[model samples]
Target: MDLNLRHAILSNISDNDQSQLEATIVDAIQSGEEKMLPGLGVLFELIWQQSNEQEKQEMIEALEQGVKSATAGS
Candidate 1:
C-alpha cells in the first residue's frame, strides 16, 4: 500500500476502529479460523476504491487460481 493512502485511511478512520481491525487480523492469524478472515473485506474495499473494474476482475481471478493451487497441494 502507498504511504499516502495509508496516511489518508489513518487520517479518516478513528484510532479505535484501526485498533479493532488490527486485533481482528491478529486473532485470525493466531486462531487459524476462516471466519476471522472478515478482515479481508477491508482489503476488498481498498481494492475497489483503488483499482479499475478490469483490475478487480484480474485480482479476483488471481485469487481463485491461488485457491485452486493451494487446495490441490493439500
Candidate 2:
C-alpha cells in the first residue's frame, strides 16, 4: 500500500481552529507515543515553511535548548 502520511496528517488538521490545533499538539506530546512523532514533524514542517527568518531562528534556538536540556537530564 502506498501511504502519504504527511498529506493524510495535514488533511486531518487543516480545518482546526487555534485552540483545536493547540489541543492536538498538547495531546500528542503528552501521549508520548512514538507513532505521534511523524505527525508532530509534519506540523513542524508546516510551521517552518510559513515562518519568517527571525521566527525560524527562534525555533532553532528553542529546539537547540530543548535538545540540550533533554540530553543533560539523561
Candidate 3:
C-alpha cells in the first residue's frame, strides 16, 4: 500500500479556520497520542515553508528553549 501521510493529514485540516487549527493543535498535544505526531510535523512543515529567515530563526530559538525547559522539568 502506498500511503502519503502528509497529504492525508493536510487534506484533513485544509479547511480549518484559525481557531479550529488552534483547537486541533491543542487537542493533539493534550492527548499526547503518537498518531498525532505526524500531523503536527506536517503543520510544522507548512509553517517552516511559509516562514521568512528571521521567523525561522525565531522559531528555532523558541524550539530550543522549549526543549531545554522540557528537559529541565524531567
Candidate 4:
C-alpha cells in the first residue's frame, strides 16, 4: 500500500475507538483466517511508519526468517 493510505489508516487507528477493531483483528488471527491478512497489512503498515530504518531492517529480517521457516515447513 501507498504511504499516504498507510498514514491515513494509522491516523484512524490513533483517532478512532480502536478496541473493537483490535478485537476483530485478534479474533481473525486466532481463527487462522486468511481473510484477516488484509487487516494485518494495516498493522504492518503502522509498524513500518512507527519504526526507524534500522528497526525496519531488523523487522524485515525477522519477517524473512519467518517466511522461510513457514515455506520450509509447507
CA-lDDT, candidates in order: 0.67, 0.91, 0.91, 0.77
lDDT of 4 by residue, 16-68 (tens): 55786777667778999886676679987667999999999999999999899
Ranked by TM-score from best down, the candidates are 2, 3, 4, 1
Scored against the true structure, residue 21 in model 4 reaches a CA lDDT of: 70
- Quote each prediction's TM-score: 0.45, 0.91, 0.90, 0.62
Best by TM-score: 2
The reply for model 3, stretches above 4 Å from the true place, is: 1-3
lDDT of 2 by residue, 1-74 (tens): 12588889989998999999999999999999988999989888889999999999999999999999999957
lDDT ranking from best candidate downward: 2, 3, 4, 1
How do the residues 1-74 of candidate 3 rate in per-residue lDDT, one tens digit apiece? 12498878888999999999999999999999998888888889889999999999999999999999999957
Answer with 2 or 3, whichever has the higher TM-score: 2
Error of 3 at 37 (Å): 0.3
- Scored by lDDT, model 1 comes in at 0.67
Look at candidate 3 and give me any clashing residue pairs. Answer: none
Task: Give the per-residue lDDT of model 1 (tens digit) for 44-70.
Answer: 576588999899899889999989998
lDDT of 3 at 3: 47
Q: What is the alpha-carbon lDDT for the whole of candidate 2?
A: 0.91
Give stretches of model 4 more than 4 Å off. Answer: 1-26
* Poorly placed runs, candidate 2 (over 4 Å): 1-3
The TM-score of predicted model 1 comes to 0.45
Model 4's alpha-carbon lDDT is 0.77
